[model samples]
Target: MNTTTTEAVPLWRRAAAELLGAGLLVTVVVGSGIAASRLSPGDVGLQLLENSIATALGLTVLILIFQPVSGAHLNPVVTLADRALGARHGGGEIAVYAGAQIVGGIGGALLANLMFAVPAALSVTDRAAPGQVLGEVVATAGLILTIFALARTGRAALVAPAVGAYIGAAYWFTSSTSFANPAVTIGRIFTDTFAGIAPTSALWFLAAQVVGAVVGVGLVFLLFPNRKAQP
Candidate 1:
């Protein structure tokens, strides 16, 4: 009998990957939003198109870059789901990953704001409307579903592009422009740009994301209960 076991990567390295990857992800998101807003000042649709393209491309590149080291789980819910789905890492790792992501997101927002020559400011744009909240739940659920379903079906290689593409589409389809990430949500509050979300509305967005995560997990189990863990 022959068996192969994967060596555990050092915790510090994984944490670093999480932090850097998450930060860069936010940078792409917020930076593109700012650029789009300015570059197409009067045309909302054109701004959205530009932002979505940049985000999709950036996310794909980021995931491809970091997936080997950290599994490229940039989102907290993705980390949680990996643990729940029997990833070798533990709860402690999850906490660290989430913390790193949150910190990175904030740092990324600040960096983007600085790059744009905009003062680092808190968002005043309120997005707590009912339609936006509902859109968040749907967007997050679809995102989670996209990730795990691919994992379950042995299509891990496709995750980067698929997830990126899904998000790009969700930006257009969802009322809230698919702010499906908690860390990203928190980070966006620091920017007063097009990508920013008001601090007052952050809690509701967070709640909706959590609800979406739960729904996504439930769907995964229902659809792939017997699936084996993938690399």
Candidate 2:
């Protein structure tokens, strides 16, 4: 489904695209969250709605912008899943992409804080709970399932919108508000805003995401076993 071959574009260039894409994705998420909080004030539901809409739209655009270069894997889990599902990336490549994504995500959060005139600080909001952890597992697993199902079925063209829609819906369906991305989750730790998560909470989220990825990959293999189904 990823038409961009490694030979067609240098790995370094692809990594750069990944960094930029991940950065912008976080920017959209954190920035919109800040705006939503300020605009909605006491109305938590309205704030969430605004944030979710902005994130969904922003993600769709970013994917379309960078998919041809790096498959627009703004999330580390997605990148790792891509590799596990046979995307032709070597171990070094995966490391580079994941590292770039994490760094870029942090940068994005910092930028959002600066833009909102808020000092960059560690989040105090703790979300470490059994229900939230289970929610993360569900959110991440569904995310992986959505992407791979489309990719494996040769419907890669629909991935951007489909992923955006899935995440938007998951925001309401999941208790953790669908922080399914490790990079984004880590980035959020830097901003003490409405969307930020504390360090301890992020650890739980990252672990759950890893578990969810494994489950999603296993499901993918089960549902689409034939190598010929993979583009």
Candidate 3:
């Protein structure tokens, strides 16, 4: 237990922290995205661009602000892999973090749906098609890997817009449209709102993301090997 993040918390407690933070993030993101979509009316591109920029800025701010408290992994997969093989190991923390992320995402989506007055879509079943899924894998892989590289190297100071920029760009370029955060993906399952996904396809996308995350970590090790941990 090097830090509070290392050994002070139980799994359920950590999950609670992660969930609370994640829920707040998703609320802001999905809420903003919907509001933009409404304001744009006909121009989805401009609207999405606006959405992306805002989201990036927001994400950066949130990560920087919360890093001290939670390390702001925000994404469960990041927390899990990082704890197991990378930085800031903590017992029972991974499960808690992952659980919280999923629940938080759901809370965010629900908020978005309420704000938007979304029609009876019942499900945001819009999973990435085959082509899109490939894009998601690449984008998510890049995102997780980049995040780990920075955090482990003590370059977390640069994280202001790291997840935000990655997420915004991934939204623009990827076919699966970058389900960059596993928690966000799960949270979105609750509603067919702006960022929602159908339950059936959620698992597949999640599976791909896990794979992408692994690949990303491996690449990081090869390209930017870690320094020996200090005494």
Candidate 4:
């Protein structure tokens, strides 16, 4: 979610937490997707429902567990948003966080593949359709708005649940199934399972996410111009 209040935590420890959290978060996503495909067979809708529910609940728990140490900014977009919103993180720290997240995400996907007995192969699932790109923009934008809106309003306590819920709903509402986080998106590329995305398609999604982040930050400034000073 937000990392603005974790300045006291050493940068290395924070980065480790981010890595673990991001890794586990992707494990939940990719693992659930694989499980759902097996559990639901031909029913794509049912598979998505199972996947979304698992991801939402798992993410909430991960955030709760890691937030104290690292603020649990598992997504690069979230980390960047924290910096853009003046969260006291320097460029170096931001790079560390993002690097850890990406590395962890790839590890998570590999773990999920190994656990599911799936070969570690690049995904062939192409998701570069125009509608999917649009879906990513909306999904990423909503995700940023949701996280910062609560953080700036001093409702940081709600970030875990709210983010979980938003992503779960976005899975159904958005055509791209709400791969809102760039780290997670990249991770999915390592698995050829149900949740995986082709590398070529990932480029479009990553770009859309960046654009969405900018739009989201603009919206935050528009709606919550004055960030409440933390005690």
Candidate 5:
């Protein structure tokens, strides 16, 4: 005879959060890269350091702000992983979340370009080397594992800081600078900058990320066999 008082967030609101969060995340990534490139034109190492710090801080903030609304996926692979593990229900949700992320990411790239006074331009960076591909696989796998492992272990609250720290570390460790999110990778193609990837290179990177996601899912099952995937 008891009635439930908690109501789910409306789909529109959830979608809006995803869009805003993803957009701002990309804006931070691309804008920071641009600023870093200009600020440290001669020192590649300094540029990377600047870019990684900004991205880490930005991601932590975005995840913390939007997590309650839509789980703060901000990445298609994360959404797909949620569905695969039954943490989230419905293919419709996946479609909506992924679509919003991609749209938001593209808008973010354009916005960054405009802010930097650079004309909208496609990336010319050809990051298709074998070493770069290997780096991408490793980077994405590590990222997914970091997120899901915390989520499965009843440490979901730590995901924001953990994920941010992981990405910042991966940037220095991976030759490809850890472009782990598919939507973010696609967005980077719209701008020729320190962080951008050529359109052709992005296709290969996406394929590697998908493979990495599968590896990460398998590892999650292996490591946390008894827990439900709850990201």
Candidate 6:
């Protein structure tokens, strides 16, 4: 258990580790979300709540599993932002991690879609209404900011429970009740089912999520005031 944060681990190995970690997380998030969506056919609120709860549990497990290997940064914005903020993970490694996460996420979504037999319409169309965009932004920003703070505080292990718990609660607290990762967002499109976002509107959500991630980084700087690099 050489968990020293400064030394660079093997790029290929880290990439592979993160890919599997993120892929498993996305699978459970989308798959269990499908089950929740089917449970509450008409009640959008209930359905969203179920999706969030399942996602939180899934994320918790992923963090516990992958924290040692790749920091479990399943989101591109998070990987890049952490690097920029003087974290130990390198830029080249971040790119590989992000790429792997995207691939794994897409694969997970496809599997979930086929497993649940989701409708094509749900996969191709934008599910995020314009009215919900603000929540999407604030919620995502809050998540990223929290992540930075946790990392700086040397509480990376808490990320899993925190994200999972927050996502589960976010469904009830926020208007959008959406998962904010771009890879996960796009991956959901393949499922074309309960957790799916339309391909057409995916870019806008992606942009919003990135914006939120930026805001989160800024917030972390203001709140945590990192004097030097963290791991």
Q: Which whole-number lDDT from 0 to 100 does residue 25 have in model 3? A: 77
TM-score of each: 0.95, 0.96, 0.86, 0.98, 0.94, 0.88
Task: Please give, for residues 123-181, the per-residue lDDT of candidate 5 as tens digits.
Answer: 99999998989898899889888987877777788889999999999999998899988
lDDT of 1 by residue, 1-42 (tens): 000112267778878888999898999999999999988999
Clashing pairs in 5: none
Question: What is the C-alpha local distance difference test score of each model?
Answer: 0.86, 0.88, 0.70, 0.93, 0.85, 0.73
Candidate 3 residues 1-231, lDDT tens each? Answer: 011232454545555656777887787777777787788878878777777777777777777655656667788767766754555655555666677788888887787778778654556566757876677679767886777666566666665567777787887888776777788877777766555678777887888888887777777778767643322
- Model 5 clashes, total count: 0
The list of candidate 5 runs beyond 4 A from truth reads 1-7, 228-231
Q: Residue 174 of candidate 1: its Cα lDDT?
A: 99
For candidate 2, the TM-score is 0.96
Badly placed stretches (over 4 Å) of model 3 are 1-14, 88-91, 119-121, 228-231
Better of 1 and 6 by TM-score: 1
Sequence-dependent TM-score of model 6 = 0.88
Best by TM-score: 4
For candidate 6, list the clashing residue pairs, or say none. Answer: 56-164, 125-198
After superposition, candidate 1 runs with Cα above 4 Å error: 1-7, 229-231
Worst 10 residues of 3 by lDDT: 1-10
TM-score of 4: 0.98
User: lDDT: which is higher, 5 or 6?
Assistant: 5
Runs with alpha carbons beyond 4 Å of true place in candidate 2: 1-7, 227-231
Looking at model 4, residue 1 earns an lDDT score of 77
